[model samples]
Structure formats: structure tokens, C-alpha cells
Target: MKAMIKVTLKNGVLDPQGKAIMGSLQSLGFNGYDNVRQGKYFELDIEAFSKEEAKARATDMCEQLLANTVIENYEIEIV
Candidate 1:
């Protein structure tokens, strides 16, 4: 089974890196973009009997280490 995890900042959180990217984009003439949010992606190959199991395991991984629960949100996909 393959597990895909996406970690991103929660709403109302400050993102300096995203701000810097947006600034650079405008300077490079990539206009009309209002915001740029950054995130983390992880792909894992694991042994699981079903999609549910794979998603559960990936969720555990995110909560334990991959994501900062207090300030971040995570989504799990099994493929």
C-alpha cells in the first residue's frame, strides 16, 4: 500500500516563508496571486491489508512526527 501525507499550516497561523515566496513572485512579474501557502508532502510504501489501514498508519505518523498538530493540519490518502 502507498500512503500520501500532506501537512499544511492551519488557518490564522503566520507563514513567513509563504510571504517571502509571494513577494518574490510579484517581483518576478507573477502578478494577480494573492497568497502562497507552503506545505509538506510525504510518500510512503507500507504493508497494509486495506486502504483504511494504510490511512490510519499514515495519520498516526503525521500526528506523531510529520506534522505539528497545534499549528498544522494533515490529510492522508491511500493509493
Candidate 2:
């Protein structure tokens, strides 16, 4: 089974890296770059009988390590 996880900051959290990237883009003459935000993606291969099972395990992984539950939210996709 293959599981992909995307972790992103929740709304109202400060994102310095995203801000820096946006500034850099503007400096490079990329006009009107509306906004930018940063996040993380993970791809994992595991042994599981069903897609739901894989998603459940990946959710656990997100809660435990892949994401910060308080400030970040995660979504899992089974592929």
C-alpha cells in the first residue's frame, strides 16, 4: 500500500519561510505574486490489506510525528 500525507499550518499561524519566499519572488520581478504558504509532503509504502487500513496507520503517523496537531493539519491519500 502507498500512503501520501500532506501537512500544512493551520490558519492564523505565522509562516516566516513562506513570507521569505514571497519576498524573494517579488525581488526576482515575478509580478503580483499574490500569496505563498509552505507545507510538507510524505510518501510511504507499507504492507496493508486495504486502503482504509493504510490511511488509518498514516493518520496515526501524522498525529505522532508527521504533523504538529496543534498548529498543523494533515491529510492522507491512499495511492
Candidate 2 global Cα RMSD? 1.0
| C-alpha lDDT (0 to 100) for residue 7 of candidate 2 | 96
Identify the runs in model 2 with alpha carbons over 4 angstroms from their true place: none
User: What is candidate 2's lDDT per residue for 1-79, written digit by digit as tens?
Assistant: 8898999999899899999999999999898566588999999997899998888999999999999989999999998
**Cα TM-score per model:** 0.95, 0.93
Model 2 Cα shift for residue 75 (angstroms): 0.9
User: Per the 3 Å backbone cut-off, how many clashing residue pairs does candidate 2 have?
Assistant: 0
Per-residue lDDT of model 1, residues 1-79, tens digit only: 8888899999999999999989999899898668699999999898999898888888889989999999999998888
For residue 48, model 2's alpha carbon misses the true position, in angstroms, by 0.5
- Pairs that collide in candidate 2 are none
Worst 10 residues of 2 by lDDT: 28-37
